[model samples]
Target: MSFLGLIGCDNGRNIRSICKNNPEICADLHKDSWCLAEKTKIIQNRYAVKDSEVTTGKQLYIQLTDLEDYSRCIELASGVQHIIHTERTADRARAFRLSTENLSVLQEQTRERQDPFMSYYQWTRFGDTDALNRFLELENTGEVSDPFLLAQAATYYSNRNAIKAQQLYLKVFAEIPFDDFDVNWLLGLASTYRQTQQFDKTYMLTKANLLLTQQKYSEQKMLALLGGNKLLAAELDLKAQTLIDSLEDASYPLSLVKIWLESQAVAADIKPETLPVHSDEK
Candidate 1:
């Protein structure tokens, strides 16, 4: 609602200036005392929403989550006592109260909405089965294309359905830019590969994530993962680098990396499987 319009009227100003100039925006918020990090993010995202005349569902979803984050943070910050500055704590408590209510209002307004991003929020926040179904239906119809949502659904299947998780993870990589995505998706694919005994693939994906994140690993453990086959390890590392290069260059949707991963699955006789039949199917 117009509560989000705090930034709708401002043109160009620093965050503090925006708040100081627009009493409507910062009146209910704590005055630069607590939850500063979350507060900054909330204001920034609201500014983004206000600046975008055509606010996508993703932007709204982000605003919802940012408010949620600020609410939770301030809720904790509201508990401390300040003998000399008693009003600071009171201010935080008020901010917490307002943020919590705003978040609830926002959620209520978006509940039962058909957008995949909003459905994701409803499903996660309320465990709404219908929201989940709507999300998956949109996904199946090729409307759920955001990389974050896709990776999350891939993760949702990881523990219950290895093949399905693997497919979804690959789809994420195939569809989004490398830098725009989290390396954790790479680790998700690695875990899926391991679950199905595709050891080579497991190592390759894990290596790719490690390489991209610049995370260090144990040489002994790494060597053992490949059973001391230095040549094969080198080859897989090369493949991983090639995959990263392709993604960085926007060379996907039919990238050689996808072809390589799929060919390996075929070579191993791994058949694609839908999610394991479960209560989720209902």
Candidate 2:
């Protein structure tokens, strides 16, 4: 796809220049772009369901007629990220349910800086309809000004209600520094911006993430490159994989990078086949 087709922007020059100097960024962009391309193909398949019956917290709560059995399943998949990236609605629902249940237990055990909206998330996830209504009734009556609480509340509404989520994220963004170096909230806000068609904001946040990541690991990446130009590509690829694995949901940022880099790669004259061809193959 063309640059405009992928990210609907003219930031190609900036992307190309930055990525050329930063092979780690280039490698990461390539991986994410490929994954996103595959995801798009999967999404275009007819067998993929148009709407997940139980994808949302509310829907899962209602569909899990046997709460105990489903809850057990949720417990098992508690740490799985990218729940929404699945092609299967059932899988997505299961992951969401597990996350909510896990959070519920963790909230009870810890007495530290607790997210004020823990009850809200827990009740919504398990489909405790009556309880959720009661909690919302009490919680919504007052204005929530706590930065941590507002961010958590925003996350609760994320994906389920995009507009509301965007609003909450915007508020939180104002409170947080631009150079926070924290991935969680920044990424969340960027997703909301993209969903809301705020492409400029999305591009800015995505670029910031790239710059932050590059700066953070510049020393290590440079050392690998200096070892030998011959091993640089392989070394960068390994580092990218390690970084992707460390993320809660690598695909999210990867998708963003893929979109921007699709065009950037072209502008920089970067061919898709970055690896050195084998002598036998050649």
Candidate 3:
């Protein structure tokens, strides 16, 4: 029997149709629905299911538009033994107003699981030496329960302890899939590399962010482009200029064009104060 057959009659048609038209899309939808289902029977019975079954489901839910389903998916994905990807996916999706409730659930789950990764005192000094000691203690304790310990360590390192931050971020970066964290972490890590004079790693991360921006050119792209990663800013600035030049010769809105150009300038580190005022006297 086909995998879609197990999704049940009501869902099977939709899943099969979506799969027939676009297999990737169908897989994503199926994964999202399966993530919300209390049991993994729908997914486990489908075919060869990987250990990342929950992770796959979370990815699908993050791409979905239904608030109710998205919320359920977040709830199910939270506090799992493995969830770096799920956390990042939920964080990015929650940036959209449609997924606010799901974001809230994820945050609540994180709060509930706080002491599991860090002690109450360690959480207080999240960016201090004590936190580092706690992280090392966790690593040495031989209880690999929470993967987000690296994430917390990276955050602390990025904030106050540059050397520690770079090491922890690199460790977390290696372990978690690229799609498993917010863009800010990537941006911060890139900036940290740049500040520590690790230009090569900075350039690599910046290029990665650029490619991601190209893949989805939304407001997030603009923010990522302008957020002080010199390499990404330089590249996006050129692209934005090319776009503006193309628009200039066409029938594009002048105001919108101005906004794009201004944003590009900001990304490129050009002072907005020096920008020429557009006169409507024409």
C-alpha TM-scores of all predictions: 0.76, 0.31, 0.34
Give residue 275's lDDT in candidate 2 (0 to 100).
16
> After superposition, which runs of candidate 1 have C-alpha atoms over 4 Å from their true positions?
1-13, 51-55, 159-163, 175-180, 195-197, 211-228, 241-258, 265-282
**lDDT of candidate 2 over 1-282, digit per residue (tens):** 332343443334434433455444333122222233322222222112224452432222222322333344444443444456543444544444653564355444432221234344456554655545554454366445545556766787777776776666555544543343255665576566556554333433443454445433233322322333335444444444433343334342444333432221211221221111112221
Model 3 TM-score on a 0 to 1 scale? 0.34
State residue 249's C-alpha deviation in candidate 1, in Å. 6.6
Error of 2 at 137 (Å): 4.7
Model 3 off-target regions past 4 Å?
A: 1-147, 178-183, 215-282
Model 3: per-residue Cα lDDT over 1-282, one tens digit each = 444564545544544453565453324222433353422332233232332434332232222224444446655454343355575455434433334554455434443232324342334423545545654566546442343556665676685766666656555544554345445555566666555554434444554554444443333333333343555556655554443343335432344433332221212342211111112222
Report the CA-based lDDT of candidate 2 relative to the real structure.
0.42
Quick one: best TM-score, which candidate? Answer: 1
Candidate 3: residue 158 Cα off by (Å):
0.4
TM-score of 2: 0.31
User: Candidate 3, after superposition: displacement of residue 164 in Å?
Assistant: 1.0
Candidate 3 backbone collisions, by pair = 157-165
